[model samples]
Target chain A: MWLRLNLRHRIYAILTALVIITISGGLVMVWYTYRMERLFSGIIGRDLVGFQVAAALEASLVHQKGFVSYYYLDGDPEWLRRLGEYRQIFKERLREAEILSDTPRQQEILESIRSEYNEYIQIKDRVIDYYKTGQRKALADVHPQLRELFFHIVDQCEVYKHIFTDQIQEARAEAHDQAEQLRYVAGAAILLELLLALFLAFVLVSHILGPVRRLTLAAEGGEGPGRIDNEITALSRSVRGLIQDAGQVHLELERSREHLLQSEKMALVGKLAAGTAHSIRNPLTSVKMRLFSLGRSLVLSDTQKEDFEVISQEIRHIDTIVQNFLEFSRPPKLQFQEISPSTVVDMALQLLSHRLDAYDATVTLQRSNPLPTISGDPEQLKEVLVNLIVNACEAMGRGGAIVIREETAVLPRVGKAAVIHLSDNGPGMSEAVAAKAVQPFFTTKDEGTGLGLSIALRILEEHEGTLNIQSAEGEGATFTIALPVKGADT
Target chain B: MKTGFDILITDHNPHVRRFIAREMTAAGYRVQEAECGADVLFQVSGNKAVDLLILDPDLPDIDSAVLLQRLRKRTPALPVVIHAFSSDMEDHPEYLKSDRFVEKRGASIEHLKEVIQDLLIRR
Candidate 1:
């Protein structure tokens, strides 16, 4: 399901799953910590209760008559021997109680028990001295206070035992409550974690993967990259870029194929034109020769002479059209030479001087200090200049300035060649027209064959030059011809 | 200029052949015409005095290079001029190891006359 999702959704789902795992892991840790704390508290409470009970029992034993008798007869031979044996038993029991006390509360109770036992021992020693001195009244007078002290200590022992029992009961209840609370909390955490995990899984599979699934369907449906949107826009962008690149490549291939087909068609046309021209040239030549000979031989009427002149002019026009067709279709072999571009421009301007004068268009040359020499057929370069100048003149119609600028600058280095830019400024073409200007037979003028620019472009390509056009609707057009400057080795 | 030599023009088109013939006649030279290589060979074999041959590079029957070699074998001294219409001539310059190459499109009648006159004078 996640694989079916788009890239963006897939990333989001992965993050969500990670978050869920992290949160669930944290909850489990909390639950474990809570359980361990509860167990520790219960053990401490049990130790405290056991220490309190042992301390109370030791206090009661110290206040009993057996304890008093054992301490008072310490000087008598038999009684002293019995008292020593009882003291040993009492010390053993006190050590056992101290060993049982593990918690801080248990240790405090054992300390109190040790201090009270020491106080009882001091009282027993005083009573034994009195008995040894034979002080009968004194022993009787101290007898009441000793009995009262003993009874008071016994009451304290009973109170201590009761408090220990109460504490033990409270601790047991707290432990039970903690256990129940732990079970509830652990169960709740597990349930919540499971629900959260399920929710996260559902979110990943539904919202995130849902759109991705749709995208996959769309892609498989052949709807292409444009159909994707929203969070998956990056994927859409990349897909769109790929699709656009492919489309452009396909379009370029189609254009190339069309160009090849057109060239084939033009080749056929050229062959036919050549044959037709050959056939027509003979008859036309004979007619012209015969007409010239007839004119030399006869004195014709004005009307007949006018008719002959018209016929001759018409034939000449047809001849010119046919010649243009042949020249345009079958260009002459290129004899490439390293020639100065300025010289070619000069020649072109000289040839078009009359037309420039008619249009009142000025030709300006802003040349580089030392123009690089380019290798090209001189005649073909002249033709390109002628065509461009003529086009500029036609565009200006009434009158406009034509600037022919030459600049020598290195293009971004591609391999080992530099590019020279020759730009022209004239009444510019619209984007739509400029795009189609290089196409054969795509004419903007009524009398134009539209072959001039096409032929110029072909000639430039033959010279390994690229022609680029930049123009707006109103702000004139600049045609920049970039020719790869020959390197030193070439 | 005594009609010093007889020339054979071999081309597929009758109009081209006639044009060449007329041009040669105007230059005061004897001219013969053949529409194909076989006709040229037949005419030459049948006792026609053929001194020079002006041929189209593309012939229907025989390859132009092969025809040139065969003609060279037959008449070692005969000067041949190849009139090529296609730019494919650049690929096969060996075939054009002839006396001269006259491009048909740009070469005027005067130019053809000059080449022939030069050849005759040189001979």
Candidate 2:
């Protein structure tokens, strides 16, 4: 029944039981005290008083005997006076005993004593009269009857005393019995109180403290039992840690969501660019053909020719823009083959040799050994290298030395990879520009298509590789391309 | 009537076809224009001996793969130069099985003229 109640109800029940027990014990104490008071008062007020009166009656009666005897021996009138005073005292004591008597038996005993005492008093007076009138023989005849009446009155007084004594004893025994009953009640109350205290302790330990201990253990991941003294404090600290972890996870989710949004925007731009470029290509080709034909067949002055040539160059530039857009929009399918990146680097350098000479740039290839073979498209890899080298050449304008370093190294997250570090002695981009360097259509050059780095990044991403650019303003830029090695952890 | 290798230029755009036909005619080759896959098929199956075919392979009616397959089955010996965006055919290598793959660009005509000349001279 106790277990069925919740913690709150159980506590209330225990406390209420304790209160009732305490109140009952207090009431029992009060009732026992009141009963004891009544018992003691009965013994002191009625029984004891009656017994005292009975004793006084016996004492006064004995005093009367001695006084009469003394008067007979000495023939003194003072003895007769003392005997009379004692007789009055005996009568007053007997009357007081009669007034104090509550039972019929006690009253009957008092009535017998009163009648016998009155007869004795008359006989004693006659004996005194005979003694005063010179009648010794008459006095001698009544003296024995007076003595017997005195003995009888004293015996009745003893009976009355015995009655009061018995009543006083009975009241004492009743008080004692009540006290014994109260003692038993007190013992039972104490035992009940002890049981209640034990039950309350059990409820506290099992229902309250037990759950708290378990919560503390769970909060602490059950590590080092009893290590923390305060379970509440430990639980609060654990909750705080959990909140912090959740906050960190929320922040990471926010960052990833932003990244996903950016990727989605890029995809939309790619689709738009592809559609626009495809439509523009056909018209653009016709214009170029017409321009070429006009340039070949028409006669013109040097200025007109320059104007014509400039128009052609601008048109070609537009075509290049369109081409870049198309390529950016339409990611080419990668043709994967087992090939060394070193070979691709050599091919790009060879292909861009004339362009490098035109830009007054120097090319340097550094490799300890042929880098490990990777599954990649050689043509696409060469295009990425060409774009990077061209970007460096343009950034430097002249006298830029491009170093292409190839090596096999273990990269974090990408494991074993063929690392290519293409560093250039050129005025590097600022932090802001470098950060946006690989984004589409972000460029610093006047004639740049701005899709070179982005396309290269995309191509490298397709190959499960990464392109990282490290640069500071006024310092040269190093573009690192890491391609995971074939049959290596990626 | 010109006395030279008969070359057929196929493109969806009439302007592009006219441009290529003019350029090829100026280059001293007999030129024919076919703006769709059906025209190219009709011309190739006809009595007019087409020495070479310059195909953009972006016909509206027929899929490029099926068009190329039909063209190949008809004229196995005739040279077919695929003229389309490089990105368009980058994923479909089957389109590159033609005699030539010319990326359509601003300077594509010059390259196309060279390919046509080479193919006709070889034929």
Candidate 3:
């Protein structure tokens, strides 16, 4: 079930677990350290208090005796033994205090205790001396001084006890404060980790899961545009581009297949044309010879002569049509040269001027200023223009103006190519026809071989040029040709 | 109009060989026909005074362009006419270059006759 969750949720869960473990471990360590510190502080406080009480009791005994000979003069072994026991206990307490002292302040306080303790011992020795020598006058004279010295020793012991107790209390307070801080920090850390985990989960859901879901929905052909998240936006864009490129590739492949099919069809036509022309030409040659011979032998009537002339003319027209068909079916061997587009257009216009005049149609020429020359077959380009112009003239029929314009505009946004648009106001083709205009042997004309546009398209393709067609039913058609401008060879 | 030179036409297709022979004969020139590259080579090597060699690029026994090269080596001055199936002769001019290039389809008989006559006269 956990593995089934998304990555974001999983990450959040893992981090939350880590934070809880870390905070709990830290709190546990702090609690343990506090307990140990309190324990040591209690032992130090008890030892210092015991030492102070023992010092006070010994001082009171010395003060009541007026001198150190009170116990020795009375010969009280019990007091002496009690004092020895207290001294031994004090020595043990001092050793324990030294063990507890970790700082310089605590060490200084211990050193003071040692020095005051030694001074008390020296006073006790003096009292013992007075008792041993039987010096009553000396004991009476030093009585007040001894009392003062004992009180001073008691004061020092009290001060040492007070200092240790204060230290123990301060350490306990600090440990309590630290433990409280750790608790607060752990609580805050756990809370923040929870919030962060929740935030991360939300982000993952929206940025990753949301986009993926939308993509799936889109793939399923759901309605409306898919909603994409920020994290997937880049990937989506790239995928969109890849899809577009694939579409273009598919289109190009389709076009190439169509071209191959057209070429195959043209090859078949060429074979047929070759055979038909071969058979027809011999018979036609014989017919022409026979007609010539018959015309010379007979003094024929004017009508007969005129009939023969018409027959010959009709034969010539048939021959021309067959020849054109053969040429259209056959592929052309291109002669490439650097030629200006204007020159090709002008040549085409010149060839078609008479037809245009007969139709009462005027031809207009609009050329790019200082048109750049392109590397292509000039004769082929002219043939393409001638075909287009002648077709336009035929469409206009009685009379219509044909607008021939050329421009060298940079189409960098589309691709690095120079574009030329040729628009005409002649009768435009239907969408269906326009789509298949470049297909071989597909023509609307009664006598059309239907290879003109196909050949032109092939030539343009050979020159690495694109032929774009735009047409409406009555608004006329525009043909835009885009070719890459040549740069210096590397 | 008859010319002394005899033109030999070699092609895998019988129709193309016959067409070329007929056109050449019509133009008043003697004609010989070879169905394959081997037959062409055999005829040329057997002391047949062949003035022009009209061959298709793809033949049965040998590659037409290579045969042309071999023929050129044998008879350097023989004007060869290449009849290509496709229009992309310009792309492979180095290999397909002959005295004249004639497309198998849509070529005028007059054009072929005129070119052959020019070559013979020049020779």
Per prediction, the TM-score for chain B is 0.84, 0.91, 0.83
What residue pairs clash in candidate 1, if any at all? A6-A212, A428-A477
In candidate 1, which residue ranges exceed 4 Å CA deviation? A1-340, A347-362, A372-379, A390-401, A408-436, A444-448, A462-464, A468-478, A484-490, B19-30, B62-66, B81-118
Q: Could you estimate the TM-score for every candidate? A: 0.50, 0.74, 0.46
- The clash tally of candidate 2 reads 0
Candidate models: Cα lDDT each: 0.68, 0.87, 0.69
The iRMS of model 2 comes to 1.5
- Model 1: how far is A188 from its true place, Å? 12
Docking class of 1: incorrect
TM-score of the first chain alone, every candidate: 0.45, 0.70, 0.47
lDDT of 2 by residue, A1-490 (tens): 8578889999999999999999999998888888888888888999889989999998998777776667768888999888878888988988888888889999999999888888888888888788788698887788788888889888988988899899988988888888888889899999999999999999988887787778777867866466778767777787887789899999999998987997898899899988988888878887887787787789999999899989998998998899899889987878899999999998998999999999989888898899989999999999999999999998898888989898888888578999999999889988899999988898888998788999999999889899999999889999999999978655
Segments of candidate 3 deviating more than 4 angstroms:
A1-338, A358-360, A412-419, A462-464, A484-490, B1-33, B47-59, B73-123
Clash tally, candidates in order: 2, 0, 1
Task: Rank by TM-score, highest first.
Answer: 2, 1, 3
Model 2 chain B lowest lDDT segment of ten: B90-99
Docking quality band of candidate 2, CAPRI definitions? medium
- Tens digit per residue, CA lDDT, model 1, A245-269: 8999999999999979977876776
